[model samples]
Target: MATTDSDTTTTDDTVLSMENVTAGYGNTTVLHDVNVAIEDGQIACLIGPNGSGKSTLMKSIYGFADVKAGSVHFRGQEITGRSPQANLKNGISYVLQDASVFPNTSVHENTLMGGYVFEDDEKAAQRAEVLYDEFPILGDIRQQDAGTLSGGQRRLLELARALMVDPDVMLLDEPSIGLEPRFIDDVFERIEQLNDLGTTILLVEQNAEKGLSVADRGFVLASGEIKFTGTGTELLNDEQVGRLYLGG
Candidate 1:
């Protein structure tokens, strides 16, 4: 699917939506009345500075963090504050920032872990091999322990593991974090490829410029609220966004 002209204006097919969600930690409020929509097979990027509640919002959607109010609907089903297991069952895969894979586990083991929702080992191994094909590097490193892989490789491994579940929407938290410049481009390119293949990606990125550049739509979140929303091109050309995020 092609990208839309406006960020806030979603395409005809919307896959996931957050309606007036207000969530936070135990006592501190982070997201306030946040709203965003992702169309089927489109890459939707969320950009903001640190502490802007980007990851917090994602965590709330996945039931990792407490959702104080509002609802997150995926494929038109209410999923707000649903258990992590339930979310995974609903085909929503979340790739956390802190490398959720077991450091001591082998790449194949981490990939197989995504099969928590699947009971059959044969089916799990088959899905893992498919993902390994998608991420060729994982194919050769399948026997290697995840801890020994480089930063970029581990991040790619995370994505492969996420795919093992065949999710409808993949929640990626700061995918480009700790990646070198070349690997960053590769990562975003693969994101586009995934979107092309009918995956809805909700990506949180610190490098707003690169994020929006490859995204179909972009949302600028500041202090937990959406300040600006537009097409990737619109956000790229905006003088303020350029001045702040694009190194103007």
Candidate 2:
């Protein structure tokens, strides 16, 4: 069973940790003194009501939002204020909440874009082929324009593209949002498969029950602060968490 801790101290197995992090867009703080840590190889989910700063927390780690205070660490290195490109090169990848596909571009071309940091085009193509093998559906529609893909297909493509770096940690913001009910299950399944393949994922999900069900560690964020932290099963059964966040 996975151990649970409410504190923010980094452990020997912690791969990503945010300590007293205050972050937000310019002149507007969305997260406040938030502390959380993701253990290596675990799927950690953050679930909260709207405007609770879940996405801001993600951005704080990836260098999208300005972190006004505190620090972020990856694999024991203090990487506070690192550039997004530097983070990606150091084995972290982020998938934003918005649609990020290049609509006019072919699916394969979009996948290739993920490897933009690679020095050689041939290396990028080689990496894309490995991803295509993992995501065969993308390989089948490699020549198709990304604009034509269904919601599920598009989500898969986004996931495939992000995998081009073979990242050690993946920050996913609202991955299940906008997907059909049928597609949601498929996406969650794919998330689990990725975890099984050794990717540590930090997910911000709107579907509280679904997110917690697959999470190894779960956090409840409210009003830009962490309200609760526990093993997923513990939070799922907590009466207060259910009544307030999970819609009892």
Per-residue lDDT over 1-248 for candidate 2, one digit per residue giving the tens place of the 0 to 100 score: 22223465678999999998999999998998888988999999999999999988998999989999999999999999999999999999999899999999999999999999999999999999999899999999999999999999999999999999999999999999999999999999999999999999999999999999999999999999999888888889988899999998
Tell me the spans in candidate 2 whose CA falls farther than 4 Å from its real position: 1-6
Give me the runs in candidate 1 sitting further than 4 Å from their true place: 1-12, 244-247
Scored by Cα lDDT, where does model 2 land? 0.92
Each candidate structure's TM-score, on Cα atoms with residue i matched to residue i, is: 0.93, 0.97
Among the numbered candidates, top TM-score falls to 2
Cα deviation of 132 in candidate 2 (Å)? Answer: 1.1
Model 1: per-residue lDDT, tens digit, 113-183? 98878978999999998898889888998999999998889888888888888988999999998889999
